[model samples]
Target: MAKSLQARKSELSDQEMQLKILSGGAFETGELPTFKAQLSKHKIQTLRPKTFSILQLNIGYMCNQVCSHCHVDAGPDRKEMMTRKTMEECLNVMKEFTIETVDLTGGAPEMHPDFEWFVEQIRLTGVSEIIVRSNLTIILANKKYHQLPGFFAKHSVHVISSLPFYKKNKTDSQRGKGVFDTSITAIKMLNKVGYGQANSNLKLDLVYNPSGAFLPSDQVALERDFKKALKTDFDIDFNQLFTITNLPISRFLDYLIASENYEEYMQSLVDAFNPTAAEDVMCTNTLSVSWEGKIFDCDFNQMLGLKSAVKNPHISQLNQNELMQRELQLSQHCYGCTAGAGSSCQGSIA
Candidate 1:
């Protein structure tokens, strides 16, 4: 493992470098409490799947901006993408299983060549919800994508975006130079299409992740602060704020290692473990599908190459019952989900 990590250090993209550091056992201090033991102490003998309802499809790892803490390590250089064949398989899974929500993610899911086509196809299946996890700035990324807001509104697509902070310096420091301004411009554009309006059915939600090695503040309180600030400052209105805990993986793990705060941060997650939150972790209901068709317990596990604990790890190989019967692949990174109020794509669990 050490030799492999050393080899990767030479040409590893920052994203792969972090995963290598983790899989190489460089970040496991042995001093922190094991996540499973925490479960046992709280009488959770086993973590099992509740149902298979949310189908999260990662279209590809291509993105326009390289954020400091992106778990996918997606940027302009990534070449891996989902083909129409794989997407057809995913759509079949959705139809056969009657999956309630179809979650679309990516470096910028919109960056996928077949993204819009995929959404159009999924809508025809009559799925309840189609969520597009966007980076916000992508709406203003290029002239070709200018029509995205109206397109989303026309389809009633639920939009969830990343907004690190309401201020410029904090947001720019984490995302990149000029990203904050571009994001704000994108928000206004969405508003023009009724994305954040109160009476509009269009749902526009924002996600906030801490910029450093710490758990996020309360979701409800932070949402209040965000609403007041965005309204007074930019007249922006959105449905909700999802405060996500930064998992110790990918670029975030790199930041923790470089800053010499890895041990402390790991301990922080361990100390905040909530059994109630453990019961509702997103993995219990959602199955994450990689760009190439591999299935995972969740998006974080997808990044770490922790495939589902089933015989067949790809979507094309497994049926719905086989998926729900599979156990989750857990690791130290899971502490991010069970810590504090607990975190998921939706927000706090407890």
Candidate 2:
């Protein structure tokens, strides 16, 4: 195992060199090969026929911020929100499938005009779990939405916020300056609403991606640091810390290619492949849905615009039996999931 980790690091070292040279060796710690390699492992390709869960619903593609590593490539440019009629179709389909969970995603899923109506309808279904991937800052984006924390609490929805880091500087660099402050505030709000408190029925999960470019430090260790820091200063408490690996797709892929970090990152992933993590990958359960109502095994495939080649690729026209029987799409980026400790939307798969 030690030798394998070393080999993986060495492979990343080569990519790190290229990435550094691309910017005249100005690459920061986040741009390092080790981190890039870590991000590359989680392919998130789903096994349809064996799927244990279904990720239904897409609010649309409209966001308040466009981060450097955003896989969605979302911004003011995206105008493809799910129409009310389309959402009704989704709800109709939902009644037919025994989907254990509903994972709602988008540029800013809440930005969709019909987002509330959709969520309310889903609430009626009372699925086992409801997950909403939020940017944190959005909850406090405006007066109307400022009360979202309360709404989420009322519906007993699980909240997943992308904080990037507990530190101000690193978070600002990847997301945007001042984003750290807003995110922190948002967390505190959720904490007030009982989202992150221990033993609280409301489940609150915080997501951590690499800052510069190194695989995340130990998840247990990082969680400790965040707990200590947020508690002492911000008085915020949260549940599990999910250490996700970034995938080489969309904006991040462009960053790597333009900065010449592509080959190195790819090589690093191939070397660090871990067999154990691959077996328990998120694709075993979760099904990712895209902005235009498209379906993928996971979010990574959605970033690359890789659609299901299965019998029923589009979620609107799903064929459960056939989709279940089809083989998943494969790509070089899959190494990210099999690397040391592995990675997935839920954090370290290993």
Candidate 3:
């Protein structure tokens, strides 16, 4: 049998592996502008948390399809999944804290055996909204997950799915063959459930990530293009289009190294660094919890094995007090969030 993704991940720290991948590049110390120094120059050396409104939980790394730019490298081959026990722990945190939003992500969060149960539990905790970072393809991967659209609507779950481009060829090139067609079908299904309707409380949003080494086009322009193209081509509508920069990590990192675009891409990110965006980076407000209950400042950090600044970085020891005051762990990949118009889980910061 093949080794599970988690089993392979456990063999070595992701951070160490990332260093090895960028070994021959211009990523040497003192070469690139340090994220902290940029913040300090802006006179906001330390980023503090505001109200803890969002709880971002990474359920696991098991998905229906593997995309080129997927930072998690999740696919059908991954067997690591969150147990009901860990989910129960997450529910406990939600019940204890006044967290208003719960963002569930994974290889494909819907693939988790206890996904529905966890969503139901968190909804009972009175979270105002739940965001599922769906890959789109999963909604139609099989009969088991086909009912996800209605299921999501029933619970008022906000769906934020990835549709790399409004065009089929570009999207399929980055995601997989026939992904664009399935994604359009999925969007139409979501629309049928009143997800993207103008007055519906059920919200459906699309996320756009650049398919190559370049930074994303202007978010406003890209959103306009996506809306026009998708509406014209598929008769589909969504609440909003979020443009996220592809962070330099995971499979994307490998692509950068292989194509010898590592230096140029990193330089572009650093050159386009916007300090304003850094102040409101999602990590400052959201706490990322891994499948096994480990905690990090953000999902990117989670993938890189950069733990939270809290002395006890686990869901069991979640300390809102310490977490609020601790400094975040940042690396070159953070430039992805600060480049140009600024990127975050939601969309552009400024």
Candidate 4:
């Protein structure tokens, strides 16, 4: 019986492993390393990262489209969502901190029923900057969201939209088919509202992540190529290009196992660990809040169900004095944050 079961297990294929990882959960196999160990190997501190002047908030975990590589694994099925009441609590807490920036993110942040209202409320505050990380295609996913560019314009939001790559094949391969076209259309609309052009008050930034198994190329070089290619081939215009690394998490982990690239990707990241990037990690300056009003050290940990240190736990029960004194959680996956030139939502952290 033991031999028979062993034989059956040996017959399991890559696709089989992927299905198990995807449906039952990635941890079912226990093959992947923990988030903290990965960070420690790279000499990156997985500890209480300092709170800087900026704050990056995850408004909710619910999103309309389920992309193939979404680190958060956000989609229509997700029930852990943020409510208006909780958002009000976040707003209340916002008043206690001297933060100059409030960044809102989500499955599709704009999909939040009160997304516009939240934006308006944040706008009313004297925060010096507002950054919205958007999946460009979401802007044209439906008619109701058609006027998003104008809304962003009104708020003067610093738009960081993901394009994966300028080529249709690459972008669609990672995100989804037809995503490239929709994203292009959204950019055109943003350009009309002064998004990417030089000297344009509307700040439009493009985010690029490699399609597979590697860290992103240099930012300045990639940005130049993107600008020239978009202008010549697609007649598109945008501001700075941000290069981000695709984190190993959620659906992406499933992809790695399915494609037989898990080991390769992990080893690649470990090989390219960059010390300079460690000094300016996003978590050092930004605080991340989950959909249910829980505080996290960073967005990555929030996705992994890691909560803030003891002094501050639940956002709903936030105490500014307590939060200011607490330490942070750390993990192995943080290697992705400091590898190579380093990666954050706004490109290289170093």
Ranking by lDDT: 1, 3, 4, 2
Off by over 4 Å in 4: 1-46, 319-325
Instruction: Give the Å error, residue 46, model 4.
Output: 6.1
Q: CA shift at 159, candidate 1, in angstroms?
A: 0.2
Better of 1 and 2 by TM-score: 1
Candidate 1 structure quality by residue, lDDT tens digits, 1-350 = 01222124523344455455554443455555577767778988778799888999998988888787877777777778999999999988877886899999988999998988999999999899999998998988899899999999989999999998888888988899899899989999999899989899999999999988889989999999999999999888889999999998776776788899887888789889888899999999999999999999999889877889888888888777777777788777888999999999988899
lDDT of 1: 0.85
Count residue pairs with overlapping backbones in model 1.
0
- In the range 115-149, model 2's lDDT, one tens digit per residue, is 77777898887577788888988887888889889
What ranking of all candidate models by TM-score puts the best one first?
3, 1, 4, 2
For model 4, how does the per-residue alpha-carbon lDDT over 20-117 read when each residue is reduced to its tens digit? 43333332344554445445555754454566567677887666666777777676665566888888887876776778898899777888888889
- Give a tens-digit lDDT track for model 3, residues 42-156: 8976777766788999999998877877788777888778888888889999988888889999989999988998888888999899999998889898899999999999899
RMSD of each: 3.5, 8.9, 2.5, 6.8
Q: By TM-score, how accurate is candidate 2?
A: 0.84
lDDT of each: 0.85, 0.71, 0.85, 0.75
| Poorly placed runs, candidate 2 (over 4 Å) | 1-49
- Model 2, residue 46: what's the lDDT? 48
